[model samples]
Target: MLIFSVLAAAIAPGVALLAYFYWKDRYDTEPLSMVVKMFLTGVLIVLPIMIVQRGLMIWLGESPFAFSFIVSAGVEEFFKWFVLYHIIYNHTEFDEPYDGIVYATAVSLGFATLENVMYAFGEPATFGTLLVRALLPVSGHALFGVFMGYFMGRAKFQEGRKMRFFLWISFLFPFFWHGLYDFIMQSVPRSWIWLIVPFMFLLWYRGIRYVNRANSVSPFRLLKREEEVKS
Candidate 1:
């Protein structure tokens, strides 16, 4: 009973978050099946990579501090991006600019869910820890997903030099954000924890703006044009 409760508490928040984002981008939401598949892809890829990374860190006789940021932020972000590029980048569902953020969020949330479950099982079994992990760390994964999606969307839908630049910037944005967040929490004074709140707010704000901008066309107009062409 206790273990089941812990698993439920851990899994709920991340799944809920992924749902919220999927709902928000109603314009060009991919099929639920595809989202689930992409998410599973993230989990499968990360599991082994994390093991290898941990092994390499231990082999080098490095302190946890020596590699935590790089492993947590750099390596994780790279794998997420790689999975997005390889699996979903050229799919037919990636039709609109906003699709990028949606798919990215799906993958990130998948990784966060499994990680949260492990933490919930391993740590001191308590509601508070579950709450914090759900609210902060899990949400952090979604924010990183938003960052990756924005650029990937731009790269795919937008054209010319500016779009190309956005693509590159998008690729780096999640990595930098993930690294900075982990670094501050690990090394900074407790007083500085407040700083992450505003940063998180900024990420959410930017993510919403990016999606809205990408889908600026009126739905009715688009539908009419398609119908006219079909007729």
Candidate 2:
């Protein structure tokens, strides 16, 4: 059916991206149930994010900067960070650095997937439209998750000033990145659409670097090496 095709097109990118991050956790994977729970929590927050953004738009006026930075990016990223901080940050399954990437990406992709489906159903979306959405918005969300998770991973095993710093960076870095991304997409002229591709690639490169960094310092990886040496 046409509807099924549309749904598949809309959901595939987010799911694929999530799977990629999940796979990147080469040591000490989180329980599947916890990741799914985080994802569903993300889906549930979309309505609340919309409600808050709507109120902010009315109050702040729909200027491009305010909408992009505050109403949209600020609200969405904050909610995502909140779910991570409150739920997964201190949980037992968050035992390794890479687990941060897995959980954060799960939540972000869930939010992105539902958003994609809504956008697709809102109008007659074409293959091109869905592809663009996948490459840009959905992937963008995943990248933001990468940034957040990378810092939170560091913060988890740190102490005192270091812990606080990484914790704030986890939220702030994603907020700024998300805001800048939205501003460019919403404010740029049609002729400047070409700018988006390069920016996206830059984000993707940085995200992968973060993933690598997180995995490199994983306690499980280090422990495995130590055991092999002892044997």
Candidate 3:
């Protein structure tokens, strides 16, 4: 059926991207149960996020900048950060830098999944809409999660002022990146559409670097080497 097909297409990109981040942990993988739970939490989080955004828009009166940055980017990333901070930041299973990416990706995809479904419902359920959601919002959130998780991983192991610094960075950086992305998409003149592609390239370039950095310094690599030495 067309409806079912639309739903599947809506869900696929976020799921695929989540899987990519999960297995990228060359040192250690998080338990499937925890990842799934984190994801569900993300799906559930959509309600509160929307409620707060609606209230804020009512108070502030909506504009393109506010909608792009504050309502869309700020509120969404803040809630995602709040949950990640409370839930996974200090977990024992979060044993390495890359676990940051793994957990964050799970939550991000969960949020993306429901968001895509809603978009599909509103539109006429076309392949073009599916492709647009996949290319932009879903994948953009994954990259944003990577940016947040990388810092949170460091914050986990750090001490004193360093830890505080990293924690704020984790929360703030994603908002900055997401806000920029959303702003470009919403506020730019149609004649400037050409600029959007390069901006996306910038985000992806930074995302790839963060992925590499997280992998390179994974605490699990050190721990595994220690175990092998004792053997």
Please provide, for model 2 over 44-85, each residue's C-alpha lDDT reduced to its tens digit, 9 standing for 90 to 100. Answer: 999999999989999999698998899988999999999999
| Model 1, runs deviating above 4 Å | 59-69, 159-164, 217-221, 224-231
Per-prediction TM-score to the true structure, in the order listed: 0.86, 0.96, 0.94
User: What value does the lDDT take at residue 90 in candidate 2?
Assistant: 86
* Candidate 2 ranges with C-alpha deviation above 4 Å: 226-231
Candidate 1 clashes between residue pairs 3 or more apart in a chain or in different chains: none
Candidate 3 Cα errors over 4 Å, as ranges: 222-231
- lDDT digits (tens) for residues 122-190 of candidate 3: 878788878877877898899899999999888888999999999999989998989888888777778
- RMSD to the hidden true structure, all candidates: 3.4, 1.4, 2.0
Candidate 1 per-residue lDDT over residues 13-61, each given as its tens digit: 8789888888876455679999889778766876876786787676655
**Could you tell me the lDDT of residue 43 within candidate 2?**
92
> How many Å off is the CA of 56 in candidate 2?
0.7
Candidate 3 lDDT for residue 121: 90
Using TM-score as the yardstick, the better of models 1 and 3 is 3
